[model samples]
Target: MTHKAIAFFDLDGTLLDDKSQVRPEIKVAMTQLKENNVLPVIATGRTEVEVAAIMKEANIDSDIIMNGAFIRVDGTVIFSDLYDKNLIEEVYSAARENNDAISFYNEKEIWCNEHNKFLLGAYNFIHTPVPPVNPDGYLTKPVNMLLILGQDNDNYYASKFPQLNFYRNTPFSLDTVKKTVSKGIAVKILQEKLGLTKVPSYAFGDGPNDLALFEACDIKIAMGNAVASLKEQADFITKKNTEGGIVHALKHFELI
Candidate 1:
Protein backbone atom coordinates (compact mmCIF):
# COMPACT_ATOMS: atom_id res chain seq x y z
CA MET A 1 0.00 0.00 0.00
CA THR A 2 1.23 3.47 -0.86
CA HIS A 3 0.89 5.71 2.17
CA LYS A 4 0.25 9.41 1.84
CA ALA A 5 2.60 10.11 4.77
CA ILE A 6 4.66 8.19 7.32
CA ALA A 7 5.04 8.82 11.03
CA PHE A 8 7.65 7.17 13.20
CA PHE A 9 6.80 6.95 16.91
CA ASP A 10 9.01 6.35 19.92
CA LEU A 11 7.27 4.20 22.50
CA ASP A 12 8.17 4.99 26.08
CA GLY A 13 7.46 8.54 27.15
CA THR A 14 6.15 9.26 23.65
CA LEU A 15 3.41 6.85 22.61
CA LEU A 16 3.08 4.71 25.74
CA ASP A 17 2.31 6.28 29.11
CA ASP A 18 4.28 6.09 32.37
CA LYS A 19 2.93 2.62 33.11
CA SER A 20 4.09 1.39 29.69
CA GLN A 21 0.52 1.26 28.45
CA VAL A 22 -0.95 2.97 25.39
CA ARG A 23 -3.68 5.52 26.08
CA PRO A 24 -7.13 4.95 24.59
CA GLU A 25 -6.96 8.20 22.65
CA ILE A 26 -3.66 7.14 21.09
CA LYS A 27 -5.28 3.91 19.89
CA VAL A 28 -8.13 5.86 18.36
CA ALA A 29 -5.64 8.22 16.74
CA MET A 30 -3.76 5.26 15.21
CA THR A 31 -6.92 3.91 13.61
CA GLN A 32 -7.73 7.35 12.31
CA LEU A 33 -4.21 7.71 10.89
CA LYS A 34 -4.56 4.47 8.90
CA GLU A 35 -8.00 5.49 7.73
CA ASN A 36 -6.46 8.74 6.49
CA ASN A 37 -3.76 6.81 4.57
CA VAL A 38 -0.98 7.85 6.97
CA LEU A 39 1.41 5.10 7.96
CA PRO A 40 2.25 4.76 11.64
CA VAL A 41 5.44 2.88 12.46
CA ILE A 42 6.93 2.28 15.90
CA ALA A 43 10.51 3.46 16.29
CA THR A 44 11.73 2.31 19.67
CA GLY A 45 14.80 1.08 21.55
CA ARG A 46 12.80 -2.01 22.51
CA THR A 47 12.87 -5.46 20.89
CA GLU A 48 10.09 -7.01 18.80
CA VAL A 49 9.09 -9.41 21.59
CA GLU A 50 9.06 -6.58 24.10
CA VAL A 51 6.55 -4.60 22.06
CA ALA A 52 4.46 -7.42 20.50
CA ALA A 53 1.42 -6.85 22.71
CA ILE A 54 1.53 -3.09 22.41
CA MET A 55 1.85 -3.27 18.61
CA LYS A 56 -1.19 -5.53 18.40
CA GLU A 57 -3.15 -3.28 20.73
CA ALA A 58 -2.41 -0.21 18.60
CA ASN A 59 -2.92 -2.06 15.27
CA ILE A 60 0.56 -1.08 14.11
CA ASP A 61 2.34 -3.71 12.01
CA SER A 62 5.54 -1.90 11.22
CA ASP A 63 8.46 -1.00 13.49
CA ILE A 64 12.06 0.17 13.64
CA ILE A 65 12.97 -1.77 16.72
CA MET A 66 16.16 -2.14 18.83
CA ASN A 67 16.95 1.46 18.12
CA GLY A 68 17.17 0.44 14.43
CA ALA A 69 18.98 -2.85 14.56
CA PHE A 70 15.88 -4.42 13.08
CA ILE A 71 12.99 -3.30 10.88
CA ARG A 72 9.69 -4.98 10.23
CA VAL A 73 7.42 -3.47 7.58
CA ASP A 74 3.76 -4.37 7.39
CA GLY A 75 4.34 -7.36 9.67
CA THR A 76 7.25 -8.63 7.57
CA VAL A 77 10.89 -8.65 8.63
CA ILE A 78 12.69 -6.70 5.96
CA PHE A 79 15.97 -5.66 7.61
CA SER A 80 18.24 -6.66 10.48
CA ASP A 81 21.67 -5.56 11.63
CA LEU A 82 23.04 -8.24 13.89
CA TYR A 83 26.04 -7.83 16.18
CA ASP A 84 29.41 -9.51 15.61
CA LYS A 85 29.63 -12.48 17.92
CA ASN A 86 33.28 -11.92 18.79
CA LEU A 87 32.67 -8.26 19.55
CA ILE A 88 29.67 -9.14 21.68
CA GLU A 89 31.79 -11.62 23.64
CA GLU A 90 34.45 -9.04 24.19
CA VAL A 91 31.91 -6.53 25.52
CA TYR A 92 30.30 -9.20 27.65
CA SER A 93 33.64 -10.02 29.24
CA ALA A 94 34.31 -6.36 29.92
CA ALA A 95 30.89 -5.86 31.53
CA ARG A 96 31.45 -8.92 33.65
CA GLU A 97 34.69 -7.41 34.89
CA ASN A 98 32.71 -4.37 36.02
CA ASN A 99 30.02 -6.54 37.65
CA ASP A 100 27.45 -5.36 35.16
CA ALA A 101 25.11 -7.75 33.41
CA ILE A 102 24.56 -7.79 29.64
CA SER A 103 21.33 -8.77 27.90
CA PHE A 104 21.26 -10.15 24.39
CA TYR A 105 18.33 -9.46 22.07
CA ASN A 106 17.02 -10.94 18.82
CA GLU A 107 13.65 -10.54 17.13
CA LYS A 108 11.93 -12.98 19.46
CA GLU A 109 13.74 -13.15 22.80
CA ILE A 110 16.10 -11.43 25.23
CA TRP A 111 18.61 -13.19 27.47
CA CYS A 112 20.97 -11.75 30.03
CA ASN A 113 24.22 -12.96 31.50
CA GLU A 114 22.95 -12.65 35.03
CA HIS A 115 20.03 -11.26 36.99
CA ASN A 116 21.05 -8.43 39.29
CA LYS A 117 19.78 -5.15 40.63
CA PHE A 118 20.67 -3.21 37.48
CA LEU A 119 19.11 -5.80 35.18
CA LEU A 120 16.02 -5.99 37.33
CA GLY A 121 15.74 -2.21 37.47
CA ALA A 122 16.06 -1.86 33.70
CA TYR A 123 13.25 -4.31 32.98
CA ASN A 124 11.16 -3.11 35.92
CA PHE A 125 11.29 0.46 34.67
CA ILE A 126 9.92 -0.78 31.35
CA HIS A 127 7.24 -2.84 33.15
CA THR A 128 8.68 -6.16 31.87
CA PRO A 129 10.02 -9.16 33.64
CA VAL A 130 13.72 -9.96 33.70
CA PRO A 131 14.93 -12.14 30.83
CA PRO A 132 16.21 -15.60 31.51
CA VAL A 133 19.88 -15.95 32.49
CA ASN A 134 22.23 -17.29 29.84
CA PRO A 135 25.87 -16.33 30.04
CA ASP A 136 26.52 -17.47 26.47
CA GLY A 137 23.25 -16.55 24.87
CA TYR A 138 24.83 -14.17 22.39
CA LEU A 139 26.80 -16.98 20.81
CA THR A 140 23.71 -19.11 20.44
CA LYS A 141 21.37 -16.61 18.80
CA PRO A 142 21.54 -13.88 16.19
CA VAL A 143 21.78 -10.91 18.52
CA ASN A 144 20.56 -7.61 17.15
CA MET A 145 21.12 -5.41 20.20
CA LEU A 146 22.77 -5.70 23.61
CA LEU A 147 21.71 -4.03 26.83
CA ILE A 148 24.56 -3.15 29.18
CA LEU A 149 22.95 -3.18 32.59
CA GLY A 150 24.78 -0.27 34.18
CA GLN A 151 23.89 3.22 35.33
CA ASP A 152 27.12 4.89 34.20
CA ASN A 153 30.15 4.22 31.97
CA ASP A 154 28.48 4.55 28.58
CA ASN A 155 31.51 6.52 27.44
CA TYR A 156 33.70 3.67 28.59
CA TYR A 157 32.10 1.31 26.08
CA ALA A 158 32.09 3.93 23.33
CA SER A 159 35.78 4.55 23.86
CA LYS A 160 36.55 0.84 23.82
CA PHE A 161 34.46 -0.01 20.78
CA PRO A 162 34.45 2.70 18.15
CA GLN A 163 32.76 0.17 15.87
CA LEU A 164 29.61 0.15 18.00
CA ASN A 165 27.07 2.73 19.19
CA PHE A 166 25.89 2.96 22.76
CA TYR A 167 22.72 4.80 23.76
CA ARG A 168 21.81 5.23 27.39
CA ASN A 169 18.06 5.36 27.00
CA THR A 170 17.45 4.64 30.67
CA PRO A 171 19.40 5.28 33.87
CA PHE A 172 19.69 1.55 34.36
CA SER A 173 21.15 0.41 31.03
CA LEU A 174 22.78 1.26 27.71
CA ASP A 175 21.43 0.11 24.31
CA THR A 176 24.29 -1.14 22.16
CA VAL A 177 24.23 -1.70 18.41
CA LYS A 178 26.43 -1.32 15.32
CA LYS A 179 27.77 2.21 14.88
CA THR A 180 25.97 2.47 11.53
CA VAL A 181 22.62 1.53 13.10
CA SER A 182 20.07 4.05 14.36
CA LYS A 183 16.38 4.80 14.07
CA GLY A 184 17.24 7.42 11.47
CA ILE A 185 19.10 4.94 9.30
CA ALA A 186 16.26 2.49 9.65
CA VAL A 187 13.72 5.15 8.64
CA LYS A 188 15.66 6.03 5.54
CA ILE A 189 16.00 2.39 4.63
CA LEU A 190 12.30 1.81 5.16
CA GLN A 191 11.42 4.77 2.98
CA GLU A 192 13.68 3.63 0.18
CA LYS A 193 12.59 0.01 0.32
CA LEU A 194 8.94 0.96 0.29
CA GLY A 195 9.43 3.58 -2.47
CA LEU A 196 8.15 6.38 -0.23
CA THR A 197 11.11 8.70 -0.52
CA LYS A 198 8.99 11.65 -1.64
CA VAL A 199 6.32 11.16 1.00
CA PRO A 200 6.11 13.55 3.95
CA SER A 201 7.57 12.04 7.09
CA TYR A 202 7.23 12.89 10.77
CA ALA A 203 9.02 11.49 13.80
CA PHE A 204 7.75 11.59 17.40
CA GLY A 205 10.13 11.08 20.27
CA ASP A 206 10.98 11.99 23.90
CA GLY A 207 14.48 10.67 24.63
CA PRO A 208 18.11 10.67 23.54
CA ASN A 209 17.69 7.57 21.39
CA ASP A 210 15.05 9.36 19.36
CA LEU A 211 17.50 12.08 18.32
CA ALA A 212 18.57 10.15 15.25
CA LEU A 213 14.93 9.49 14.42
CA PHE A 214 14.19 13.24 14.43
CA GLU A 215 17.10 13.91 12.11
CA ALA A 216 15.70 11.47 9.54
CA CYS A 217 12.18 12.85 9.39
CA ASP A 218 10.72 15.86 7.56
CA ILE A 219 8.76 17.06 10.62
CA LYS A 220 9.97 16.39 14.15
CA ILE A 221 7.33 16.33 16.90
CA ALA A 222 8.63 16.06 20.42
CA MET A 223 6.54 15.47 23.48
CA GLY A 224 6.24 18.31 26.04
CA ASN A 225 7.90 15.97 28.52
CA ALA A 226 10.71 15.26 26.01
CA VAL A 227 14.28 16.01 26.83
CA ALA A 228 15.25 19.63 26.32
CA SER A 229 17.60 18.64 23.51
CA LEU A 230 14.83 16.93 21.54
CA LYS A 231 12.29 19.68 22.22
CA GLU A 232 14.73 22.22 20.91
CA GLN A 233 14.91 20.35 17.62
CA ALA A 234 11.22 19.51 17.27
CA ASP A 235 9.18 21.25 14.58
CA PHE A 236 6.18 20.94 16.91
CA ILE A 237 6.12 20.27 20.62
CA THR A 238 2.99 18.42 21.65
CA LYS A 239 1.58 17.84 25.11
CA LYS A 240 2.91 15.19 27.46
CA ASN A 241 2.30 11.57 26.47
CA THR A 242 -0.20 11.03 29.26
CA GLU A 243 -1.81 14.35 28.27
CA GLY A 244 -2.68 13.14 24.78
CA GLY A 245 0.61 14.02 23.10
CA ILE A 246 0.21 11.60 20.18
CA VAL A 247 -3.36 12.64 19.49
CA HIS A 248 -2.54 16.32 19.84
CA ALA A 249 0.33 16.11 17.40
CA LEU A 250 -1.69 14.03 14.91
CA LYS A 251 -4.52 16.49 15.10
CA HIS A 252 -2.14 19.43 14.76
CA PHE A 253 -0.75 17.89 11.60
CA GLU A 254 -4.25 16.94 10.43
CA LEU A 255 -3.13 13.31 10.17
CA ILE A 256 -6.12 12.04 12.15
Candidate 2:
Protein backbone atom coordinates (compact mmCIF):
# COMPACT_ATOMS: atom_id res chain seq x y z
CA MET A 1 0.00 0.00 0.00
CA THR A 2 1.39 3.37 -0.99
CA HIS A 3 -1.15 6.07 -0.26
CA LYS A 4 -0.95 6.79 3.42
CA ALA A 5 -3.58 7.97 5.90
CA ILE A 6 -7.32 7.47 5.55
CA ALA A 7 -8.98 7.22 2.14
CA PHE A 8 -12.65 8.25 1.87
CA PHE A 9 -14.33 6.48 -1.04
CA ASP A 10 -17.57 7.12 -2.85
CA LEU A 11 -19.63 3.97 -3.23
CA ASP A 12 -21.97 3.96 -6.22
CA GLY A 13 -19.50 4.59 -9.00
CA THR A 14 -16.31 4.53 -7.07
CA LEU A 15 -15.98 1.44 -4.94
CA LEU A 16 -19.10 -0.73 -4.96
CA ASP A 17 -18.98 -0.05 -8.69
CA ASP A 18 -21.40 -0.23 -11.61
CA LYS A 19 -21.65 -3.97 -11.20
CA SER A 20 -22.89 -3.37 -7.67
CA GLN A 21 -20.27 -5.67 -6.19
CA VAL A 22 -16.97 -4.66 -4.84
CA ARG A 23 -14.71 -6.67 -7.12
CA PRO A 24 -12.60 -9.32 -5.50
CA GLU A 25 -9.46 -7.48 -6.52
CA ILE A 26 -10.75 -4.25 -4.97
CA LYS A 27 -11.75 -5.92 -1.75
CA VAL A 28 -8.38 -7.53 -1.59
CA ALA A 29 -6.69 -4.22 -2.18
CA MET A 30 -8.73 -2.53 0.48
CA THR A 31 -7.91 -5.28 2.93
CA GLN A 32 -4.24 -4.79 2.24
CA LEU A 33 -4.62 -1.04 2.48
CA LYS A 34 -6.22 -1.44 5.84
CA GLU A 35 -3.46 -3.74 6.99
CA ASN A 36 -0.98 -1.15 5.82
CA ASN A 37 -2.72 1.51 7.92
CA VAL A 38 -4.71 3.21 5.16
CA LEU A 39 -8.27 3.36 6.39
CA PRO A 40 -10.85 3.13 3.62
CA VAL A 41 -14.12 4.77 4.56
CA ILE A 42 -17.24 4.98 2.41
CA ALA A 43 -18.36 8.45 1.37
CA THR A 44 -21.44 8.18 -0.76
CA GLY A 45 -24.69 9.94 -1.72
CA ARG A 46 -26.65 6.88 -0.66
CA THR A 47 -28.73 7.19 2.47
CA GLU A 48 -27.41 5.25 5.45
CA VAL A 49 -29.99 2.53 4.92
CA GLU A 50 -28.96 1.96 1.34
CA VAL A 51 -25.28 1.91 2.18
CA ALA A 52 -25.85 -0.53 5.01
CA ALA A 53 -27.53 -3.02 2.70
CA ILE A 54 -24.97 -2.55 0.00
CA MET A 55 -22.03 -2.92 2.33
CA LYS A 56 -23.53 -5.99 3.94
CA GLU A 57 -24.19 -7.62 0.59
CA ALA A 58 -20.64 -6.99 -0.44
CA ASN A 59 -19.31 -8.19 2.94
CA ILE A 60 -17.39 -4.96 3.22
CA ASP A 61 -17.94 -3.28 6.57
CA SER A 62 -15.82 -0.17 6.82
CA ASP A 63 -17.83 2.91 5.88
CA ILE A 64 -19.11 6.34 6.76
CA ILE A 65 -22.44 6.63 4.99
CA MET A 66 -25.26 9.11 4.23
CA ASN A 67 -22.95 11.46 2.47
CA GLY A 68 -21.09 11.47 5.78
CA ALA A 69 -24.30 12.29 7.65
CA PHE A 70 -23.59 9.34 9.92
CA ILE A 71 -20.42 7.57 10.93
CA ARG A 72 -20.58 4.01 12.10
CA VAL A 73 -18.53 0.92 12.63
CA ASP A 74 -20.13 -2.53 12.88
CA GLY A 75 -23.69 -1.13 12.93
CA THR A 76 -23.25 1.34 15.74
CA VAL A 77 -23.61 5.04 15.00
CA ILE A 78 -20.58 6.95 16.22
CA PHE A 79 -21.94 10.17 14.77
CA SER A 80 -25.25 11.43 13.35
CA ASP A 81 -26.91 14.45 11.75
CA LEU A 82 -30.58 14.83 11.01
CA TYR A 83 -32.77 17.09 8.90
CA ASP A 84 -35.73 19.00 10.37
CA LYS A 85 -39.34 17.90 9.76
CA ASN A 86 -40.31 21.39 8.63
CA LEU A 87 -37.77 21.16 5.81
CA ILE A 88 -38.82 17.61 4.97
CA GLU A 89 -42.46 18.62 4.55
CA GLU A 90 -41.54 21.61 2.46
CA VAL A 91 -39.47 19.40 0.18
CA TYR A 92 -42.17 16.76 0.06
CA SER A 93 -44.85 19.30 -0.85
CA ALA A 94 -42.70 20.51 -3.69
CA ALA A 95 -42.29 16.97 -4.98
CA ARG A 96 -46.00 16.20 -4.89
CA GLU A 97 -46.94 19.41 -6.70
CA ASN A 98 -44.29 19.04 -9.38
CA ASN A 99 -45.46 15.54 -10.31
CA ASP A 100 -41.82 14.58 -10.22
CA ALA A 101 -40.88 11.20 -8.88
CA ILE A 102 -39.68 11.14 -5.29
CA SER A 103 -37.49 8.93 -3.08
CA PHE A 104 -37.29 10.07 0.49
CA TYR A 105 -34.29 8.89 2.48
CA ASN A 106 -34.09 8.31 6.19
CA GLU A 107 -31.16 6.60 7.88
CA LYS A 108 -33.14 3.37 7.73
CA GLU A 109 -35.29 3.34 4.61
CA ILE A 110 -35.54 4.93 1.20
CA TRP A 111 -39.19 5.83 0.75
CA CYS A 112 -40.93 6.38 -2.54
CA ASN A 113 -44.51 7.08 -3.47
CA GLU A 114 -44.34 3.83 -5.40
CA HIS A 115 -41.65 1.45 -6.52
CA ASN A 116 -39.05 3.22 -8.62
CA LYS A 117 -37.91 1.55 -11.82
CA PHE A 118 -34.38 2.83 -11.63
CA LEU A 119 -33.98 1.89 -8.00
CA LEU A 120 -35.30 -1.56 -8.75
CA GLY A 121 -32.92 -1.77 -11.65
CA ALA A 122 -30.00 -0.79 -9.46
CA TYR A 123 -31.03 -3.46 -7.01
CA ASN A 124 -31.18 -6.08 -9.73
CA PHE A 125 -27.93 -4.90 -11.21
CA ILE A 126 -26.20 -5.30 -7.88
CA HIS A 127 -28.12 -8.42 -6.97
CA THR A 128 -29.11 -6.82 -3.68
CA PRO A 129 -32.37 -8.10 -2.26
CA VAL A 130 -35.29 -5.71 -2.02
CA PRO A 131 -35.48 -3.65 1.12
CA PRO A 132 -38.02 -4.34 3.85
CA VAL A 133 -41.57 -3.21 3.00
CA ASN A 134 -42.04 -1.28 6.22
CA PRO A 135 -41.77 2.46 5.56
CA ASP A 136 -41.83 3.39 9.22
CA GLY A 137 -38.23 2.26 9.70
CA TYR A 138 -36.76 5.29 8.01
CA LEU A 139 -34.16 7.63 9.49
CA THR A 140 -35.18 10.91 11.09
CA LYS A 141 -38.52 9.19 11.80
CA PRO A 142 -39.71 10.59 8.48
CA VAL A 143 -37.24 11.47 5.74
CA ASN A 144 -34.05 13.36 5.46
CA MET A 145 -33.71 13.68 1.71
CA LEU A 146 -36.36 14.03 -0.96
CA LEU A 147 -34.84 12.45 -4.03
CA ILE A 148 -36.70 13.65 -7.09
CA LEU A 149 -36.63 13.12 -10.78
CA GLY A 150 -37.82 16.27 -12.47
CA GLN A 151 -39.57 15.07 -15.54
CA ASP A 152 -39.62 17.32 -18.62
CA ASN A 153 -39.19 20.48 -16.60
CA ASP A 154 -36.24 20.43 -14.27
CA ASN A 155 -35.62 24.07 -14.74
CA TYR A 156 -39.22 24.85 -13.88
CA TYR A 157 -39.06 22.74 -10.73
CA ALA A 158 -35.80 24.35 -9.77
CA SER A 159 -37.36 27.74 -10.21
CA LYS A 160 -40.54 26.83 -8.37
CA PHE A 161 -39.04 24.86 -5.52
CA PRO A 162 -35.99 26.89 -4.78
CA GLN A 163 -36.72 26.53 -1.07
CA LEU A 164 -35.74 22.90 -1.40
CA ASN A 165 -32.03 22.72 -1.83
CA PHE A 166 -31.57 20.52 -4.85
CA TYR A 167 -28.42 18.84 -5.98
CA ARG A 168 -28.68 18.31 -9.71
CA ASN A 169 -27.19 14.87 -9.29
CA THR A 170 -26.72 11.58 -11.18
CA PRO A 171 -28.52 12.06 -14.47
CA PHE A 172 -32.28 12.13 -14.05
CA SER A 173 -32.07 12.64 -10.29
CA LEU A 174 -32.40 15.66 -8.07
CA ASP A 175 -31.41 15.07 -4.43
CA THR A 176 -32.98 17.52 -2.04
CA VAL A 177 -32.11 17.82 1.63
CA LYS A 178 -31.81 20.74 3.98
CA LYS A 179 -29.64 23.42 2.36
CA THR A 180 -27.03 23.36 5.11
CA VAL A 181 -26.25 19.65 5.24
CA SER A 182 -23.26 18.34 3.30
CA LYS A 183 -20.66 15.59 3.38
CA GLY A 184 -17.89 18.09 3.99
CA ILE A 185 -19.61 19.56 7.03
CA ALA A 186 -20.25 16.15 8.46
CA VAL A 187 -16.77 14.94 7.64
CA LYS A 188 -15.20 18.00 9.20
CA ILE A 189 -17.07 17.34 12.39
CA LEU A 190 -16.15 13.66 12.35
CA GLN A 191 -12.58 14.38 11.42
CA GLU A 192 -12.15 16.79 14.29
CA LYS A 193 -13.80 14.40 16.72
CA LEU A 194 -11.44 11.59 15.73
CA GLY A 195 -8.51 13.95 15.68
CA LEU A 196 -8.19 13.07 12.02
CA THR A 197 -8.24 16.62 10.71
CA LYS A 198 -4.47 16.59 10.42
CA VAL A 199 -4.49 13.15 8.81
CA PRO A 200 -4.10 13.23 5.04
CA SER A 201 -7.47 12.77 3.41
CA TYR A 202 -8.84 12.03 -0.08
CA ALA A 203 -12.32 11.67 -1.58
CA PHE A 204 -13.70 10.04 -4.71
CA GLY A 205 -17.14 10.71 -6.14
CA ASP A 206 -19.02 11.39 -9.35
CA GLY A 207 -21.64 14.10 -8.88
CA PRO A 208 -22.18 17.76 -8.10
CA ASN A 209 -23.49 16.61 -4.73
CA ASP A 210 -19.87 15.67 -4.09
CA LEU A 211 -18.70 19.22 -4.68
CA ALA A 212 -18.45 19.96 -0.98
CA LEU A 213 -16.08 17.04 -0.43
CA PHE A 214 -14.07 17.76 -3.56
CA GLU A 215 -13.47 21.23 -2.24
CA ALA A 216 -12.78 20.17 1.33
CA CYS A 217 -10.44 17.22 0.85
CA ASP A 218 -6.84 17.47 -0.17
CA ILE A 219 -7.11 14.80 -2.85
CA LYS A 220 -10.25 14.39 -4.95
CA ILE A 221 -10.75 12.10 -7.91
CA ALA A 222 -13.82 11.97 -10.11
CA MET A 223 -14.87 8.78 -11.84
CA GLY A 224 -14.31 8.81 -15.59
CA ASN A 225 -17.96 7.88 -15.90
CA ALA A 226 -18.91 10.77 -13.61
CA VAL A 227 -20.87 13.84 -14.56
CA ALA A 228 -18.65 16.18 -16.58
CA SER A 229 -18.73 19.13 -14.18
CA LEU A 230 -17.50 16.96 -11.35
CA LYS A 231 -14.73 15.62 -13.59
CA GLU A 232 -13.65 19.17 -14.20
CA GLN A 233 -13.40 19.90 -10.49
CA ALA A 234 -11.55 16.75 -9.51
CA ASP A 235 -7.82 16.56 -9.16
CA PHE A 236 -7.77 13.54 -11.44
CA ILE A 237 -10.14 11.39 -13.43
CA THR A 238 -10.00 7.66 -12.84
CA LYS A 239 -11.22 4.79 -14.99
CA LYS A 240 -14.94 4.15 -15.30
CA ASN A 241 -16.61 1.95 -12.72
CA THR A 242 -16.67 -1.11 -14.93
CA GLU A 243 -13.08 -0.59 -15.91
CA GLY A 244 -11.52 -1.15 -12.49
CA GLY A 245 -11.58 2.54 -11.62
CA ILE A 246 -11.11 2.08 -7.90
CA VAL A 247 -8.31 -0.38 -8.42
CA HIS A 248 -6.55 1.90 -10.86
CA ALA A 249 -7.00 4.93 -8.67
CA LEU A 250 -5.72 3.16 -5.57
CA LYS A 251 -2.77 1.71 -7.43
CA HIS A 252 -2.00 5.05 -8.99
CA PHE A 253 -1.90 6.67 -5.59
CA GLU A 254 -0.12 3.62 -4.18
CA LEU A 255 -2.96 3.07 -1.76
CA ILE A 256 -3.06 -0.54 -2.88
Output the number of the TM-score-best candidate: 1
| Candidate 1: pairs in clash | none
| Predicted structure 1, TM vs. truth | 0.98
TM-score of each: 0.98, 0.81
Count: clashes, candidate 2? 3
- What's the CA error at residue 141 for candidate 2, in Å? 1.9
Tens-place lDDT digits, model 2, residues 1-256: 2435777777776776665667777768777777777767777667666666556544455566556556765455667667676655555566667665566666776656544554454345445554433333333365556667554556766677665456664555666655556777766775776667887888888777788878778888888888888888888899997888878888898877
Please list all clashing residue pairs in model 2, or write none if there are none.
Answer: 2-254, 3-254, 107-139
**Candidate 1 lDDT, 108-133, residue by residue in tens:** 99998899899999999999878998
How close to the true structure is residue 33 of candidate 2, measured as C-alpha lDDT? 73
